[model samples]
Target: MTTLSDLLSDPLPSGLGLSDRQWLVLSALPGMGARRLARLACECPVWPDGWLSRLPEQAASALRLWLDHPQRSPFGALFDGLDAWLTADPRNTLLHPDHPAWPALLAQLPDPPGVLWASGDLTALSLPTLAIVGSRRPSREGLHQAHRFGRELAERGWCVVSGLALGVDGAAQEAALNTRGRSIAVLGCGVDVIYPPRHATLYRRLLDEGGLLLSEHPPGTRARPAFFPRRNRIVTGVSLGVLVVEAAEKSGSLVSARLAIEQNRELFALPGSLNNPQARGCLNLIREGAVLTTCVDDILDELGHWAETPGTRSAAPAVPGSDDDDPMLGWLSDVPTPLDALVTLTGQDVTACQLQLLELELEGLATQAAGGWIRLPR
Candidate 1:
């Protein structure tokens, strides 16, 4: 495994004209957000000259003004101890915009990260990718749909990208891994600290299964509410498209879909029941002209030639005994049936019956009305 020390020891490119240490220093500077840094690069005449060792008096004054400002100073303090922490880990790599491995997709965004700390296969960033995002508390049917979509996409060749949160995100990554496909997780916090904590094992498994863990924040930054909306843009920015499995009318996943639209990337929404609050956002998105995705083909067809690659094609035989094969599923018919009555007539385990019912409902085979399951009208 290439260590951070090894990456730092490598000679800087002549075009960058900045030492590894100098790059780190620039990243640590106060008020040096992505936009500010880009402006500084443009305004400075002999760029990257004494900018590192000794700032020009005018630049130094500008830096002082930023440091004295209340808002920018505190955020800069977040990186106060990052340099030493990064130096301690051989595996931690901080990649700047000029770095060869920096993701080219991110550069096209208006506000790309100044630095990215990454682990696992950095080359995966160069591969064609898609982002799958949805509600953290998705229904069981939603999870199944996400997994199915993710697994199919992975088997076909596209790298499944997600936030690694619970529910749909977790299902997507797990499905991609199961199919021996590459996946990338873009974190809201540092890569070293798993935000949900419960997903520590999943995080470890990702490293070996052709998956990469990435973050713009340096190591040691804890997950925070404010960081996620900013983090979401990269999820959309890095991918060729974004797939939303299920989302509430005002869910965070909608933010990702909106960002994908703003980036002019394909936005695919899995159609869900209008009755399901979790599905309302997707229905709304479809109403707004986002592609209504019934299956993986809906997405692949939209990608057109890009998806013609062998990896993006699906050939797996459909599994037997899915919802369509369930005999009890036919009992509900077009009219809603009381839960207790259906349980009595079906004579199946309550949990198993409920699971099937949920799947049927999501597939548009059944509907919930007046506290009962009903078959959709013909």
Candidate 2:
């Protein structure tokens, strides 16, 4: 059987050579911005055909001229290292414009990535997908909505797409994974490097569960504020639509929603309390004509006939850690208790208790009350 690992290990055909991969890597450089690269690739004849190979003679002069006068040799050096790094990763496969597996939906975008670096189930890219994105600093309500919608959508056979950030993005991905459904994590950084370091476990689990981790950037690319908006475009471009769970006025999630609108994909917004600051972006989206969604059914209904079609539902399994083994819920009390008191009551150690509390809150098993602690929902 061809496992996802096997697929990832396989190399591209020999015809896909060093220069092509180098070009793709160069095209993905951090400050190299997509529009500028597109312009360069079009205008510089040397760039298209073994361009980097001919660099010493033709392109190097122009590149040096651009670099020296601008006093920006760092970007040029970064590009050189990118080429060397690309050569080292045997698992690295660059999906070109002609690859059959490239999602047709993405091709329609005005600025599609020149290449995609993928790990695990590349085939999943062809599946019908929906992007669920929201605030990195989401409220409790926002987190709940994201998980609920993610789980329900995964149960219905839609592959959840998310940026893998903390809060809403992490919640949605966790929900989909818990349901045994496939999800895709589009990173602002490289696939090999897990950002937010806390998500390292989730990142590894995603690989094992036949999900995918993708980036246009080469391995070793660090996460930066600027990389996110570019990453958002891919999230929106790849999906059938985008759902905004909760977002502040300045949140990156709105960027994905806007891209979805530009892509002409369906857009859904979860309405939140008007006073909650995190709800501001979603409200703005609704006012701008995005569909107001209260439940998963709202989204499925908007998908129209396709929602009812066979083989379109997600393949997620039953939620893990749902049984007695789940340490988080095991420690919760039906009545509110102070954090210090709860720690003594559970006798499970402080850090474990704190993590358990956070997990329980995420799973909707507990709610924060007045003072310092929480109580389980009756």
Candidate 2 lDDT over residue span 19-116, tens digit each: 54455545544455555444444333443354444333434544555435535544556556555665765444566543545554553455667677
Q: Cα miss at 196, model 1 (Å)?
A: 0.5
lDDT of each: 0.70, 0.68
Model 2, CA-based lDDT: 0.68
lDDT of 1 by residue, 1-378 (tens): 111222222222112444444455555576566655544543332544445435546545544544466355433454555666667755556776555555545544556666777767765665567899998999989999999988988877878899889889989989988988888888999888887887887798787766888887777789998989988898887787899999999999999998988766789998887679999999999999899999888886776534454333343212234554666665654444444334335544333456677787787777666425567754
User: Candidate 1: minimum summed lDDT over ten consecutive residues — where?
Assistant: 1-10
Residue 12 CA error for candidate 1 (Å)? 19
Q: What is the lDDT of residue 366 in candidate 1?
A: 73
Supply every candidate's count of residue pairs whose N, Cα or C atoms clash at under 3 angstroms: 5, 8
